[model samples]
Structures are given as C-alpha cells and as structure tokens.
Target: MGIYSISDLAELTGVKTHTLRVWEKRYGLLTPQRTDTNIRYYLDSDLKGTHAGVKTLQQRGTNFQDSRNDCGRDGGGM
Candidate 1:
C-alpha cells in the first residue's frame, strides 16, 4: 500500500492530471485523502478503482460520453 499524488495516478493510468481533477471535481470519480497540511493524496485503492472502472467500461462497450453513468458514482470511477 502506498500513497500517490494525482500526477502519479495520471502517469500510471495514462490519464492526464487535469482530466483526473475534472473527474474528481465534476464526476466524483476519485476521493483523495488530505494530509495534515491539507495536501491531497491517493492510496492504492484509488488506482485499483480506476483500473476497475476502465475495465468495466470496456467490458460493457460503453461509449465515452455515456460511460460515466455506469462508473461507481459514489466516488469510484475513472
């Protein structure tokens, strides 16, 4: 288990940093934790969640525009 910054997630997942932020802010896809200094960070779970969401989307043959709906919605999406 490790803590990851948004940039780390973007690099590992091939998603842009801005896109991740957008997903977090607009779609509630990621739920990052805050440090005592109020810095945002993610855990291994977030990375796994993203991968699961992507796989779910692919398996369902969901189009890019409609895929967000099926994403776990409770802060568990790509």
Candidate 2:
C-alpha cells in the first residue's frame, strides 16, 4: 500500500491541504497513518473514500464550493 503526504493527497483529490486537515480533525473523514517520526500519511483508500463522499454529496445537491464549507461547519462526514 502506498502512502501519500498531505500535499499529494490534496493534488490527487483536488482539495486544499488545509481543508484536508480540517476534514481529518473535524469530520473524521480520513485516518492517515503515522510514520515512525509521526508524520501523517494516507493510503489510496483514503483518497477513494473522500472522492466517493464528494460525489455522493454532489448528487445530493451539495455544490463543490459549498460541500467542504458545510462539512466543516456542520461536523458531518460522508
């Protein structure tokens, strides 16, 4: 399994690194593994799950611009 840094994940998911950190802390959407040095890293499944959640919310009428903001404010995941 490959692990990705925050920047890599943001690039892969089209979400900002700050937003990703917010999601990680607030929504519990991602559970990145910690390296021996305590650096955070995510697996491919994390990206896939985040993408799936984004798609689901889009289908539910949550615009991309608003979804992350809403999620951050509401503390809701998925």
Candidate 3:
C-alpha cells in the first residue's frame, strides 16, 4: 500500500514518464490518484500492473534489482 509519484514509478518500473502518460491516455494503463494539491500519485498495485516481475518480487519479498531484468530492457521482447 505504498504511494509513489510518476518519477518514482519511472525509476521502479523502468518506464519513462512520457511513455506512462501515453499509456494512461491510450491504453488506460493506470488510473492515478491526485492529492489535494493536485499532485499525482500511484499505488503499489499500479506498479505491479506495469510489470509481472514487480508483482512476483513483492509476493516473494525479493529486491527490485532483479525486476529490471524481467522488463526486457536487455534486448529481449517485452
């Protein structure tokens, strides 16, 4: 039940903020919550939806370093 900003999501999920915005607009990837000050924040569930390995790591209590490998950033298909 953690809260994260777009930049935080970008770092954790390895997805750029611009791409995230596109996904949100085109694919409905995330439904972000806004604060009283109108700051966007995302829940932990959103992070999991962005990547399967993130969900698995949370379930297994593993660190996030390995999750990056699952994101197909290393010349693999996502």
In order, what is each prediction's RMSD in angstroms? 4.6, 3.7, 7.3
What lDDT score goes with residue 13 in model 3?
87
lDDT for model 1, please. Answer: 0.75
TM-score to true structure, per model: 0.69, 0.76, 0.63
Candidate 3 per-residue lDDT over residues 1-78, each given as its tens digit = 899999999899876787677567655768889999988899999888877744665788754444435453332212
Each prediction's whole-model lDDT (CA) = 0.75, 0.77, 0.71
Decide which is better by lDDT, 1 or 3. 1
Using lDDT as the measure, what is the rank order of every candidate, best first?
A: 2, 1, 3
Query: Which lDDT value does model 1 have at 66?
Result: 66
- Across 5-75, the per-residue lDDT of candidate 2 in tens digits comes to 98898888776787777778976888999999999999989989878877786789876557757645744
Better of 2 and 3 by lDDT: 2
How far residue 32's Cα lies from its native spot in candidate 3, in Å, is: 0.6
Poorest 10 consecutive residues of model 3 by lDDT? 69-78
lDDT per residue as tens, model 1, 40-62:
89999999987787677679887
Per-residue error (Å), model 2, residue 9? 0.7
